[model samples]
Target: MPNITFHTKHIFSALLLFLVFGIQAFSKDIKQCDLLIQNGIDAMWEKDHVKSLELLTEARTLAEKNHWYKQLFLATNNIGANYYNLLDYGEALNYYLESYTIAVKHLEPKYEMIVLNNIAILYSKKKDFEKANEYFKKAYDIAVENKDEVKIGLYAMNLGNVANETNNLKKARDYFNESLPLLKSNPQFEILAKMAIAENDLLQKNYNQAQVTAETLLKTTKDLNYHDIGISLLMILSKSNFEQNNLDLASDYAQKIFARKPNLETKVAVFKLLSDINQKKMHFDLALQFKDSIIKAERELNEINNGRAFENNRVKFEIENYKKEIALNEAQLSNERKIFYSVLAIIIIVVFFVILTLRNLSVKHKQKKLIAERNEQIISLELEKKKSDNLLLEKMISEKETASLLEHEKLKNEIEQKNRKLSAKALYLSGRNELIEETLQSLSKLPEISNNNLLTNHIQTLKSHLKTDAEWDSFITHFEEVNQTFLNNLKTKHPKLNANDIRFITYIYMNLSTKEISSMLNITAEACRKRKERIANRMELSSEIPLYDYLSTL
Candidate 1:
């Protein structure tokens, strides 16, 4: 029995190990597949279409096997790009449609927008302008919704080019202008936008404006080595100059277009411009020569057009077959979906009843539990109420104490301010008394004033009034009122300080000069200074710490 149990445990452990290894291997493969898709996209950007197709095909197979819908969509779309670049429109359309279907199935709007733009470009290549415009608009709306500036600029440029082909000059100009700001970071799109603007000006018979725009575009394209745009700009310049009857300038630009060895279309345009210019100048021989060149260029252009038409027809045929296959698949899927919904509906009904039964049982159980919990909560709440009441009472007491302290501080400040004012008035009164005493003494010393008994009597009355201790008592009372705390604190801290010493410190605390203290004290400044020195020595203060500073603290 013990051996059997050990073997069973070992078997279980082996199965678990197998599952873990299997999952790890699967995850590693998924990462490798994703890396291949990324590398494929990078290759496509490098214009290695063959290498891109090989890598993307491998990624697509892996994604399909793993049921990774997102990577599958990306791989399929890049595969389409490879074929599109190779000019295999039929295969490109097939893969693009597959990617579009996957994107829609997965509800991936970003991939959907990308596939829509590719489909529009393919249709435009096929010269199915109406269908191209429809798809472009769809992609444009998605780009706007996503706030994708790059995609918006790309779609706008494509729409403008299409509009220009269809001779909708106003719409073309509007789209070109709209794309310009968004495409400023992309030099290729910027040059294309400028070229479109020049073309639009020429078409509108704004020859001077067209010439200026085209010449500027020509300079930019030449500097950038963008020969395609340069050729287009040269054609525009030739046409503009010829229209304005600048035959010599028109001939020079037309020859420049030919000298660049432009494509058949641009060459044809240049030849036609040269022919017109020569005919306008009545040079029949050169005019005939340019016309013959135009015929040859047109013949070459026709052959190219024929090949494109054949390719378009082939793509159209493939598209029709794909549509038929899609229709059949849709029909099959519709049947399957109907069966699925039927089973789903019956399961939902059973689930609803089961849920309802469980909910009723749950509610009954919960109600009993809730009743006990409510009682417990009521007990807890009562305890909390008591605690809250105590806290509230403490807060109320604290607030009342705070208010009382604030009121006491306010009243103390008011009393201090009144005492200070009274002290100032006492100082003024002391000065007045000194002046009156001085005047009386001066009169007494005068020889003419000695005979004046009335003056002498007045002086005697003033001296009697000034000699009274009432003013001193009043001044001391006021000073004590303001400095009561300082006096108390000083007396408690320094028991040896006498009333006279305290009065001397009070004058110093008031920041009064020695002369002012002498006038207030009816003593000489020297006597006031000696009093301060005596206090400082009594306090044992060092000479480095001034006596006035020490007295001011008290």
Candidate 2:
């Protein structure tokens, strides 16, 4: 009886060992499957779709074998994303539907919402707005229910983009506005939202507001080096300036967009803008040149699209084959599972002690390895944090310098504008003095006034007033205030120049015409020209250097 009890105890221990090892192996496979799926997601973020597909496919195999519903859903969804990026829309839709089915079967609302949103994006790309909007609304409702602010903003922006594409400007603007607050954390998305708003403003013929919005966004994009969004903002600015008849400014923005090496669609739009601007400016030759460029760009774009279509077809065929292979593997795994279990049960009875010893050692080894890796990661993070802090400091310094330079430029422009106004006032005063002098001369020559002593005396007093230096001195002082250091600099450069010569240079520096200068000096225009020639000679300037240009250097 004691011998019988010992044999029964041994049999019970064998069964328990088999159960424990089987469950451990299954758990290990599930963990590996999850790790692969995470790696696949990282690959997707890096835009390596081919590698991502491979990783996700391996993960899917493991998930299907172990019947891990959550991992299966993720692996399947990522597979769809790979095909979607590859432009195999048909295959992409098939996998997406499979993922959706899994999500529904498992009652996973989060996965369902994400899959729906992706489907909406795919439809929007295909220009099926009706279906896109339907899916977007469904996804948006789910996001709202889950209180996912990020997804909410993303859907709103997508809807806005679709509305803008359809030329529903009002609806697009409203949607973009709704997205702004939600997407503020993501600057790129915020920029895109504002760009949509600016585009709407342009479509509605609100050129000024559109220009302001586009320009503000443009500065932000340039600072961030966001070339893609910069292209869109530049296009909006070009259109806004074009509609407002600012042809030169429009051409400048369009040319900047071209210089950034835009893609086919943006290039076509830029070429069209250039053509229209040139045509408006009566530059028929340039217009024709841009029109030819447009044709070339459009032809290239068509060829590119065709190539993509062919590639998509090939990818779709490959995906179909891959699906068949996965199905076959599933069938084979199902057939092999019972046989494997029977074998595993017998092996466990023989190897239970050995397996337990190895597993314990392995667990300890893994713990030490994990501790080492954690230490390395901590050090790496510290170094990275220091580098980030350094980069942030450099960026702050650069921004501050840029702000300082801009402030200096603003002050310089304000001074120049004030000088221009002062010069205009001085010119008006000179013209008035000239007119009074001419009136006095004409009155003195009139026959009716020749014999009147009182009139003659009044004319004489006026002549004395014109001869006084007070008014001239006052004008010179005001001119000096506007053009600070100008007269002094000129005198320092040419000490031989007299006060009259200095005054002539000041008038030339103000960019006054020869006739205006002659009137100011109460001399003939020919005399003023001769005076300029004399000053140029005195300064020993070559004929290539005009007197006005030389005076400007002062």
TM-score of each: 0.50, 0.57
For all candidates in order, the CA lDDT equals 0.74, 0.76
Q: Which residue runs of candidate 1 sit more than 4 Å off their true CA positions?
A: 34-54, 220-223, 259-261, 284-554
As for candidate 2, its clashing pairs are: none
Positional deviation of residue 344's Cα in model 1 after best superposition, in angstroms: 39
Q: Could you report the Cα RMSD, in angstroms, for every candidate shown?
A: 38.6, 24.6
Q: What would the per-residue lDDT of candidate 1 be over residues 1-554, giving only the tens digit for each residue?
A: 46447856986999999999999999999999999999999998897765666678777867886899999999998888877865657668989999999998985688899899999999998999998998898888899999999779878888887887788989988998899899988888778877888888888888999999887776656453464776777778888888888999889987987676777877766776776787678675576577667666766665564565454444434533443444455446655755565565556455444545555666546445645655565566566556655755665576566557545644654564565465455455454455555555566677877788898788777667552457656667877776688788878878899877877787777766787677767777899888888888887889799876776676
lDDT of 2: 0.76
lDDT, candidate 2, residue 228?
A: 79
Poorest stretch of ten by lDDT in candidate 1: 315-324
Winning model by TM-score? 2
